[model samples]
Each structure stands twice: as C-alpha cells, then as structure tokens.
Target: MKRRRVPALLLDAAAIVAALLDAWVHVDPDDRAAAACALLAAISLTLRRRLPLLTYVLALPAAFVTDAVFATLAALYTLSSLTRRRSLLVVCAAAFVTGDTASWSWPGPEFADLTDSGNLITVTYSLATAAAPVFLGQLVQARRELTVRIAEISKARESERQLLSDSAQAQERARLAREMHDVISHQVSLIAVRAGALQIGNRDPETKEAAATIRRLGVQTLDELRHMVGVLRASGSDPVELTPQPSLTDLPRLVDSSGIEVELHTDLPADLPAAVQRAVYRTVQEALTNVRKHAPGATATIGVHHTGGTLRTTVTNTARTRPALVLPGAHYGLIGLRQRAELLGGTLSAAATPDGGFSLRLELPVQDPG
Candidate 1:
C-alpha cells in the first residue's frame, strides 16, 4: 500500500492538459463542460496508486465522455504498477479502445468526417500514452528483484566467513590442551612415586626428616599443578593468567622427585633446540612413570646419544622384588608424549624387556654445538 506521490502528481498534470486540449481542438463550443471533465480526471489521478483497478474502471467512463487522453494513460500506468496479471491488462486495454471509438461516434450527425484519418491519429496517440506507464512499471519491478538477490548473496558469504573463523579457533584450543596434558601428567607422576616411597622407607632420625621433606615437596607440586589448571581455565577477560610454560630444563627436578636411582649417560649436543629438548624430556618422564607404576623396586638407567643429526633417548628398568603393580590403562600420558615428539618431527616407542622389565625409546633431530 505504498503510495507513489511523484507518479500521481505527473498523472494529474497530464490529465488536466489532455482535458484542455480535447475541449480546444473540438468543433463544439462547450467550455464549462470541458473544464468540469478536466478537473474530475485530475482528482481521479491521485487515487491511482492505492486503487489501480478502480481508477482504471473510473477512467474509461470519464475518458469516453471528455475524450481526455492523459486521464486514460494515467489509469493504465496505475494498472501496470500495481498488478502483474497480463489478462487483466489486456481486458483494460480493450475497454479503453471501445470507449474511444464510442466517444468519436457521439458527435456523428453534425460532423461526418469526425471519425476519419484524424480519429485514427487520436487512437494511435492514446495507445502509446497508455503503454508508456506500463513499461516504466516493469523496469521498476526488475530493479527490485535484482536488489533482493544481491542482498541474499552478501548474507551467505558473511555466514561462510564466520564458520571458517570458528573452526580455526577450535583447532588451536585442542592443540593447547594436548600440550598442557603432556606437561601436567609427567609432573604429577613423579610426585605420586616420591610420596609413596617416603611413606615406606627407613626410620633413622635424619632419614625420617628427609622423607618428611620429600612428602612436603610432593604436596607443593600438587598445589602448583592445581594453580596451573585454574590459570588456564580463567584465560579469557580475566586478570589471572598462566605463567610461561616449562620446556625441558626443568627435567632434573622432575626426575629427582621419582626417588629412583637413575644413571644418566649422554652424548647429546648442548645446542639442541628447545622443542627437541621438551619432547625428549616428556618421553623420559612417561617412561619413568610407567616404571614406578609397573616395576616397583627396579633400578632405572637413562641414556642420551647423538649420531649424525639425530638425538636418541632410551629408558630401561629391571624387574621388581615385589609383584609388579599393573598400572591403570590410561593413554592420555603416552598419547601426549607421542604427540610432543611428533610435533618436533621425532619418533617414540615403548616395549617390554626380556627380563621382566620395560623400555621406552625416543629419537629427535639435533642441532650440533660448536
């Protein structure tokens, strides 16, 4: 029901001029009748946008009486703009032609040549006037449809961009979680082993004091682990944040906490990259955790060697005096260890030894020290 004010005004002006021209060109001298028809046609033009069908119906009778070409064209324009039904348009056109013919025949007796070549000219002019409005209306409809299609395309593209961004964010979050698992699991295993040993060993005063110290250290390590997890959880828009992550240099303290006598043999170069060091450290930690869980009372040996551009680590533990405890089958620690090694373009393997023991091996690319 949107009213087109500009088209209405133009139609009104055209109607008025048509009415004046009809009256002036005719042989009959009826100025008052001509002026009345012109005024009525102008008023009818204002209602065209709102009630196009009614305007066309009203215009036929008025045009027949006044022979106002502009009023008929204005009504035709309204029909085209408001309705898309072709049959209705054809019906309206036929009615207009019939009305024009009837109006020409009305002043027949006095002017025999009134419906002659001059009448044909009027018919042609009236059809052209009517058709002009219909063409403009079709052009407007086409423009509107094009605008709608473009808007739909723009919205689809925006949705696709947002989907890609969300997918990338999810991938990054998973990678960070894997790294955190590798770091925390290794640290927690050492604390568990040391705490278990301190509860079972010798009762001399100095020995008791050292055991209590180990127990306290185990408790402190657990607290720090909890704090680290909390910091990771409160990352977004929060003041508390996780400190820089540990890499490989912290491995000595981790190994000491296991309370296992470890013999280290190394030919690894000092210039190894931080990433390679971290992977090697994690592999050793997982191997030692397995030893503490599955091979109690066992002695462990850790060896690091470099040949060509590759650095290798191997951890081996002998059988225990007490029956070996079967560790709970959790893949998170091992899976995380393997992922860390692979991230640095390395490989890792674990195997049972022939003498009721276990061994873990890891190999990584090395940087040579001068």
Candidate 2:
C-alpha cells in the first residue's frame, strides 16, 4: 500500500486539477464559492488509498456543491477498488441523496410524492453517476486479482516439478550405489582372495611377488570404491531392485524412452567390466536427463570409444528447439559423476555447446589394479 501511494497521489492530483480547471473556466463570478468547495474536495483525495470510503464520503457533498464531477468520480473509483463495506456504501448513498436534494431545493419544489418528472431525472442522473465509475473500478480490480492468481499457480507448479526432479535423481543414485555394492565390490573381493591364495601357494619368487602386489592393490581399491558407494547407499531411496542393473547395452532402451531424437555410435568391447559398463550407462543417462529437463525437443548424439588403455564416453545434445517446462535442478548430477569417474581412476568433463545445448564426456581406464 505504501508503494502504491505515489501513483495514487499522481492520479488524485490529475483529478483535482481537472476539477479546478472546470470550475475556473465555467463557473460564474458570483459562484466562486463553488470553486472553493471543489478545491477542498480535491485536497481530501490524500485519503483515497488508506481510507477510500472516507474519501468518497467527503467528496460527494463537495462535488454536489461545487459541480466537480472529477472529484466525485475519483472517490467512487477508489472506494469500489479498495473496499466493499455495505454500511459504508449506505452512508455514501445517504450523503448523495442529501446533497442531490439540497442542490435542487433552491430552484425546485420539495420531495413530495417524489414521482414528478424532474425528480425522476435527478434520481436517474444520480444513480448513473454513482454506478458507472464504481462498476468500472470493480471490474478492473477483479481482473488484476485473476492475473495474480495465475502467476502464483505457475510458480507453484514449477516448485513441484523441481521437487520431483530432485527425488528421481536421488533414487537413481541410490540404485547405482546398490549395484556397485552388490556386484562390483563382491567381484573385486574375489580377485583379492584369489591373489592371496596365489601368493601363499606359488613357489617362484617372481610369481609370488606379483600375486602379493595384486592382493595389496585390490584391497586398497576396494576400500576406496566402497567408501564412495557407501555414501550413495546412505541416501534415502526406494528398496534396491534385485534385477541386474542397467549397462551400456541398455542405451537404446534409455534413448527410446527419453522421447528425444538421438543418434549413437560405439566401438566398445562387448565384455566391458561391470563397473566400467555401469559408469558408461550412468554418464549417458545423466546427459539425456539433462537434455530432456532443460532442452526439450533437442536432438542428442552419444559416442563411445574403447581404444588403447581407456574407454571414453560422450553424450551431446543440440539446443532446445521449442519452449519446454524447465524445472530447477539439484546441480549434483555432473559433480556426482565426476567424483565417481575419479574413483574409477578416470575423468569426466561437461560443457555447454555452441548451439546452447550441453555435452558430457567421461573417460575410464580399461583396466584397474583393484
């Protein structure tokens, strides 16, 4: 309301100026008191925003006495938009009736029978004068309220979408952690056990030393990998699925379900270790998720290369082709992937493309010591 004061003041000033001009140009010299009364009515406009009904009550009598239509209109509009008290409306009506009769009292007959043509015209004019501005102001107020409600609805919907996105990401991360724990950790422990047995049984010094080194490296890696996976497992998520987790081979299914146009190329070995395969699948999954969430209708391209001693995975998407619903993100997708890649002795990179889309790249060692 305080912020509204300045604009309201300007509008009231304009109304008062118009009333002053009408009085100065048209009123007779002997009727200068009428002009004075109109100026007084204009001065009362300061209460319009804070005390709109009071402003109206003050304005109507001064308007009747001074012939200041502008002051009356401004007061009526302010009252209609700012308040809706039936008692106040009744008071204003009483004021109007008294003023209307007082104006005609000098030149016309008293209100007797009250059905004469002159009285009828006076009544109709007064009713029209009271109703028009108030009705218009009420219409404007209703439309403004409607607009505010629509904006609130839009903001509320966006917040709900953000919450859903965060929940889904957390669930996916937890699932990944469960898979690494149940599958990769178990396999690595078996390798360590086998190495320990070899070190104990082997007779050759060279063979025994190699087996000892393998056992030590395997144990160290299992410790680090387990720590990272444990952090994910600690998250609140749905119960783990017993079915085998997704891998690189599930890329087609992910793409088909995404509803975004995608092109893919790969030169990966079919027998990639479960950990590497899972990492590659997640990298692609995250990239696609981002595209659908932020760049709807954008085309995507995914590439995998297993060359030399490393496997490199890349997913890139074009800029959004059309307007789409964008939900707020937790911003942890790429950070989590980067940490996972580092744990696997690899690297992850993501950057915006020239077309305003984004690209994610991850490179993992083809083989790890443990």
Among these predicted structures, which one has the highest TM-score?
A: 2
Maximum-lDDT candidate: 2
What TM-score, computed on C-alpha atoms, does each candidate reach? Answer: 0.48, 0.56
Query: What are the lDDT figures for the candidates, one per model?
Result: 0.70, 0.77
Error of 2 at 147 (Å): 2.8
- Estimate the overall C-alpha local distance difference test score of candidate 1: 0.70
- For model 2, the superposed segments whose C-alpha errors exceed 4 Å read 1-9, 101-114, 234-370
Tens-digit lDDT track of model 2 for 1-370: 8888788677767877876676666556576667666666677677777888778767775656655567767787878776666566556655665565545446763552457888777777877776777677778788889899999999999999988997897798788988888998999999999999999999999788778767886786698777778667655655554335678888887776566789989876677888888889888988988888888879999999977788988899999988878688899998989998999999999889887988898999895333
- Writing each residue's lDDT as its tens digit, candidate 1 over 107-204 gives 45222244588877766766665557777766666677778888998998998898788667656655565565577656765776775576567667
Residue 112 in candidate 1, Cα distance off native in Å: 22
Q: Which pairs clash in the backbone of model 1?
A: none
